[model samples]
Target: MTVREIATEAYRESVPVLVLSAVGGLFAGVVLGGWTPETEQVAGLLVLVPALLATRGNVYGSLGGRLGSALHQGLVDPTLSLADERVNAAVAASLANGVLVSMLSAVLAVGLLTALGRPSAPLATLVAIALLAGVVSGLILTVVVVSVVFVGYRRGLNPDTLAGPVVTTTGDVVGVATLLVATRIVLALGGG
Candidate 1:
């Protein structure tokens, strides 16, 4: 293919997804901005927000990239199934990393706040919230990233172009929603 053809193909495939991602990001921002009460109630929660969302995007985005590469290489089929050991393994690893990094972020946030003489929620409370949010969002992201990458590949679209934006936007939206839910749960349980 000529350079112009390649450029046109890439632009055609990616532009729509990029536009959708921008809209999704705005939605996520709205949801987050509307959660002022929760943010105020939970000290240092804002600190955890970016870290949590970034971790989801990083972990799941990598998972999506790996799956895309696998699809291209024919190492895995473009189908979600338990029989696909490579897919299963990749997902499991991503989940593990997501959860672990989430917990670490909570601890680090608390530590940083305390070191700076800033008020922070109890360590246990932050950890619980992080853990809950991580598990929920990780599961959701795994399914989403896998499905989008696989389906886009099947449709003859470049999964490489699709995975990053899709995962990042979805991760932001889901991460914020799940974090809010987790915070609410912790507060309702008198933990926060």
Candidate 2:
């Protein structure tokens, strides 16, 4: 098939997955609520939510897309009973992308917040939280996205059709959960 044909086919297959992702987002939004920080705490760790989640979703979603391509090209096995080199490559790629995306997102978010005159806890605290949260969340997101995509592929579903939406939606949910947990940990340390 031509490039256009492949693109069209991918788009067509994505319709159902898009619907499912939307539903997942709505469900997550309701369950998580605003998660907005109070006026007093607005400048603290609150702003990390969007950044962390966006990074998680983008990186994992991108990886899923690649995995889908690998699947199509017969470069992937369902059991991943591949050689050590291949396994290492997959893990390295996922981690590298995840870390890079997370750091970029965090930096961008911090810059945006600063530009908007938002109060921040401290430069060190902000950086620490952003980097730590990014790394930790990225690792978890890697597992979640890979597992979901692998399972979907095994079931004869197109990863391109399902991975992005599923990964992004789940990333939102997981991201929020991760941020909240991280915030609680920080608060606990601060004797809150």
TM, every model: 0.98, 0.76
Model 2, runs deviating above 4 Å? 1-19, 31-39, 42-46, 82-84
- Candidate 2 per-residue lDDT over residues 52-115, each given as its tens digit: 7777777778888887888788877866564636545766787787667665655666687788
Deviation of model 2 at 80, angstroms: 1.5
Q: lDDT scores for all predictions?
A: 0.95, 0.69
Looking at candidate 2, what is the lDDT of residue 108? Answer: 67
Model 2 superposed RMSD (Cα): 3.8
Query: Top model by lDDT, which number?
Result: 1
The residue-by-residue lDDT of candidate 1 on 1-192, one tens digit each, is 999999999999999999999999999999999988898889999999999999999999999999999999999977666799999899999999999999999999999999999999999999999999999999999989988998899899999999999999999999999999999999999987
Model 2, C-alpha of 84: deviation from truth (Å): 4.8
Clashes of 2: 0
